[model samples]
Target: MLFISAITFGADYDSIGDSTIVRKRSDLTQKLYDTLLSIKGNGIFFGMQHATGYGVGWQNNNDSCDIEKVTGDYPAFAGWGASVTDCNIAQGEGFEDARYKIKLFHDMGGFNTMEWHADNPFGGNCYWERRHDKTKDVVASILPGGEKHQEFLTQLDNIASFFNSLIDDDGKKIPIIFRPWHEHTGAWFWWGKGNCSKEDYISLWQFTVNYLSDEKGVDNLLYAYSPAKNDSREEYLYGYPGDEYIDVLGQDNYYDLRQDATNMPRFVKMLETLVSIANEKNKPAALTETGAFTIDAKATMPEDNWFTEKLLKLIMYNDKTRQISYAMVWRNGSTSHFHVPYPGHPAVPDFIDFYNHPYTIFMSDMEKYRTKNE
Candidate 1:
């Protein structure tokens, strides 16, 4: 499959030097285009990060409990986060679970995306609490020939091995969107705005991708570059590692972080910004992470139809915003930290309505997308 340097997003997909990777990426991209493109703009896909195979309901009940266990259905896209704590942790049980879920989603004709919550290489700092003081010099350590550079490579190699291992029943590589160093605009993570220079960040990104694609020979993945919400396109693309290194233009935002529902003007504005940038760049854009972070819709039922009223309305109703390929909510970690609603939860009725909406595509709907594309 011959590919060009510049890709017209909705029309074609770009390559990153690997033939197998190029084919898989192009196939997935075409699938996305077929599913989303419509005469009346496009359809938006509903997603949930770390949803089935693990969730708040599972934490509260049995490990077998999941979105399908409760609601009898799954989201169109499922996300997983791998943490490179010890250099070889990607080969451990946690990562094995993630791989299992990825295969499960693929077998069902749904999509899968993975991101990293990399630990600070210089010290004992974890992803969530990566303060500047704790991991300020970490990025430098991971650059070529830096003190921790070799250690970082070990992590990437293991991660690449995992990506390469995701083969389907027919012995074909399964495609997945791989997002790394997400929420770079936030002040928390070690790789965030204050911790590293744009030069260093771009190098980190390019090096990681090259090591994965060239050195490790992993070709079943598409790279996604996601940052925290920023108002202007300039601010959003400030540290971007250029078009060749990225396949998906995505953003991560939470309702609680923005202090409002999905209909919030600020939220809509950022969505517009992402969509406009994607359209101009001829790339696919997505609301990579979102949802009511802390609200227990079941207990409080605070905002009725938060799904259809706020979120679905914002994505499905708008002409331009509807072009966003997908919108994913964060993980349902616990009863206190859950994002999506469980079965019999107060938001179930509204979520059901959102799932039923023609513009909002979920897991079962993917069969139609596959048949249409076929």
Candidate 2:
């Protein structure tokens, strides 16, 4: 019921075959559609940053399993990773001087969905930015919702408008792989900071889906629900919108031996649990975010290497699985530099071997959604 069998071509997506909505320029929309198709059946949707504006092209690279896949950017640092841009022009080349820049990413191989963020589930106040308490910053809400709640709605509306405009090459809607409020189970980000109650967060999520599809009339979307490893609350992992609202289920794991105790058991278990739930619900699952610190952390090599080997094999195999569809390894060289050097990993390592073997056989061919290598 929840699992919808799908094949990602490029990025082109039409209204459930029978809806009428003026999408964005057909050319751009189609390119995205094809891109989705290219990786649809596969288990990995390698991520790119929406923060940095686009370059001429994008690449996934060999370090992680993504390997040199071209990438692009949205207007300004506006990847669905966070919240959408403000120009308020959420979608495309809307002819607005566009306070919102529309060219953030490069069109390397191009992509399927134009992911932008509305607001993170973590709270509005971030540690780095917008540290001001929501009570202090946003004007009080006049309507039923609180002021901060109202502001979140505005951001959500703006984002809806942006994604709703995508059109296929033949003047159809470009379906998006919408992964919003992702990684909410973790407390690092603002939304998951313990301020938002489960009910409140759920309201926010439900309201977002209602407004985006029902009110905004954006049909080109395949919602994805992702949670971070070592979730602070189990509700965050289970609090997904109904099947109609979600398409893929995934988890984010970054704690390697270099960071956490020993690899990402919590993350692996998180996936195992998620897969069981997804199976019950019928939706497919994926390793949406995964990576070992290429740099280095406290852990030394053999142990860390052991972690990687065990980790890769653990999630990539076993009975509970057969649910994983893709695995996107985060190999952002810049990111590796940004974080403290992973102790053992002064240099980032490549997952090409992992991807090349059983761990990734499903990539080239999506016939069986099982861990290829063990």
Candidate 3:
């Protein structure tokens, strides 16, 4: 089978030297295109750093929701969102049994990240507590230490196999959006803050995609490249393995750290840059994860809602960027250290307007996409 590789985003098309691009009529794969062109974002996309599923281990009865409740909210994606978490651990049950209910959720029609493990990327727990210790070996599984080139490939292989076990909302192979090491530019977590080099990071991302797509049978995945919308457009902003290796180009930002408000423009400009790149290369843009750090009780801050409402509007109208497809919520509201968005807050109102709003006009454009592509 022939393959056209866009090694680096927006690289010159004619000269294919260090890069790879195999052009043939039928070379494009359905899964590959899904990553690059298809698979629009779920607007009310909510993420759970620590899900209630972990309560399954203790039979504690607090795993975030009742099976009945989730079942009732099954396809109520109107304003309701889906949960994605690290570990995918079942607190009351074993990994296997916990995963079974997880599959059941999707069997009824739902979507989730089936995420790789994380140590509270934006600060919070995945399964209530730390979920699991910093078992980077169990989670990241990178070689303890070795040459950056050799180690990157080895660890990538391990991460792919771990995530491949999941099923999608159809109870079939889970077409998960695997987002491993994200927001490397931020100095917040262990993964960033000079913990790893750029070459090391890029190699890991590329190798993971190759292993999953070519080695493992996980063709149902769209690897997401996410970064905390940083103030400066630092080098880490675009540190990807190229369009071929990455399925989606994404960014993650929040109103938690600063109330100064200047970060908003930085976010808009950075997203504009990323979306432009994705659009030029036939890839779509996504706000993979975002949220405010604090939500007051009873009183929903209209001020906070303004933040939610305005940022969303900017993503849609920005001229230099691609059409912003998904604006997800980083739903880890329980953590005290750092977190802004969570459930039951007025600011995080039902965003059904994405489909209903005249600004987005999503359904109409979707029809155009379906017709033009099909």
Best-fitting candidate, measured by TM-score?
A: 1
lDDT (10s digit) by residue, model 1, range 1-374: 21223422223344423332322244444454445443125577778777665565454222243456545777887877777432233434355666677778888888888877787765555553644455357888789978888888877877877777777797767777888888888767777887778889888987887778668777667778889978778888978887667778898876433323444776777888888887776678888987763343432235547778777877755677777888887766666666667766777777778778888777888887767765
TM per model? 0.85, 0.61, 0.62
Best-matching candidate per lDDT: 1
C-alpha lDDT values of all predictions: 0.69, 0.44, 0.46
lDDT of 3: 0.46
Q: What TM-score quantifies how close candidate 2 is to the native fold?
A: 0.61
lDDT sort, best first:
1, 3, 2
Runs in model 3 lying further than 4 Å from the true structure: 1-110, 117-162, 167-171, 231-238, 256-260, 294-304, 320-322, 332-374
- RMSD of every candidate to native, in Å, equals 4.6, 9.3, 7.7
